[model samples]
Target: MLNLNQDPQIILWALTKDTYWHPDDHWQAVDRRCKELSTGEIFAVIDDIVHHFVHAPVVILTGKNVWQREDFDQILGKMAPILPSAIALNNPRLSHAALLSRWKDLGLTSVYLRLQNPRTLHGRQTVALAEAVVDHGMRLEIMTAVTPRTLPWLPGLADLMLSVGAASWQLGFNESLQRSKLDAKTLEQTLVWVADFAATSPLRVLPIGAPQYQRIVSDRYPLLDAGRIALREARGIAYINHHGLVYPGVNLPFAGGNLRQSSFSNIYRESPTFCALRDPRPLEGRCGFCDYHLTCGGSRTRAFRETGKLYAEDPGCWNPQTA
Candidate 1:
């Protein structure tokens, strides 16, 4: 029984300061990029973009600097009022007990916690964390770098499994990037390992990795396809973070070309999930071919950058070249 009225699930994964090339420029960039839109538009853009990718019922915000919880909260507070329904919190920084407490206070529906460090914890300590999560009525999503054999050692734990970064390549790729990485067989074996342990336990086993690996999974394993998986298995969800230009309808950006044109309005509408930062009316009568025409408020930034207008063709649009 799927709940149609429920808001779509989204996951906003911000890069860590170290990983972000222009850490100091983020706030300014965000403001500049979204300046043309209103609060509603911002929410719509984010919602649409996320919905386009994974139609999950839960959204998770990842890659926050938990060490600066106060700073993180401050930034989130500013964004929260607009995206009130969003469950915004630092990534798996708090202890299990602290996490439970925060989840309750924040009215969070789900949380993604990193379990990488716990592999070194004593058996008792690990058990305590696991027990606290289950007992506290908190959904435990585990992100770890440990091998499959060690997962069962923390039995009756981990309702959701997430593999991050390099560890993901270990899960599998359509084509191995390097010989050191795990092949499809190894990845399937590992998933089977976790699936066997969770056996009808209502636990979801997901391998969260790079876009390439995610695409491979989505293509190979039906269960790994976010939309299809969510529709079939009511248990858990999967998300793929890929970088691609979206256009109205099936108009993709020029393939294998550097000069791709896109329209601001089309991108917003094509985005599976996004938040609109402005009103939708300004884009009417623009981009005539856009099937989502009237409602497809163009992307202001993309439009201006490409054509110096708020309702022009996206410089990334590839329909002409393809035709």
Candidate 2:
């Protein structure tokens, strides 16, 4: 079990497609989910999960550009009906000052800007925006889609730096590799570059998805052990679409396809090393010395679908001794 002094600090939900979907349809789904959940229930669940995982705050990211103040206000108004705890503005086309002003007015706690593909700004402009965010006193997060070759030259300006895709993973599973059809060595090089960048930066590095997490934990854990990168400082955050399944505490599975075939259960199962020990009953397993048990409950739906039992032995359990 991991010994964590602090609780999980943040719970960010990527409400990406909502910006592209029709507002009413998007809201209806959200309303239905929250209909039976009282304010106290909602807060309790959120707090419990956050506390268990040591997460600090919760935020929602809208994957769209806000071009004007009115556009920002409109998005906030629409968001108000849903009453999300926080908001992350992604790829805003507006100037830094304008975006910051609007975010402040909306009472947003955090804002994430993508440094990977800046359509409107150059490197200098990106640096200026980071400066403006610090000036405005808004919590800042940065997303990078650059490889090691390109990243070193870019200014180190973000508080939290997120690798947008599987740049740190092995070749076959990396979407970028599939797009470029690169070899394994090239993929390894890119992962090394990411590690090198993280080694130099004080900002936290987050892997984008589950594949990246698998590769990092399996292949790159050695690199971390060698002190080439800080595994403790590196984290993972997944983006789930509407089809994704929600596990009460761990993560919302959104890898694609039916939840059953996604390996959600295999990767996160109830065991001494895997289950959230604090809440073992929910998972119906014993995992000793696992500090993350309560905070990192196994994927509930995945276990159900894989084993045909809601709270039974996790078919995905890999560590037989613990099982």
- What TM-score would every model get versus the actual structure? 0.42, 0.45
Candidate 1 lDDT (Cα, 0 to 1): 0.34
Q: In each prediction, how many residue pairs overlap at the backbone (N, C-alpha, C within less than 3 A)?
A: 55, 17
Tens-digit lDDT track of model 2 for 186-295: 44454555555566555555544212223333344555543221111112222223223322222222222222233322222322222332234655663223333333
Question: Which structure among the candidates has the greatest TM-score?
Answer: 2
Tell how far residue 107 is off in model 2, in angstroms: 5.4
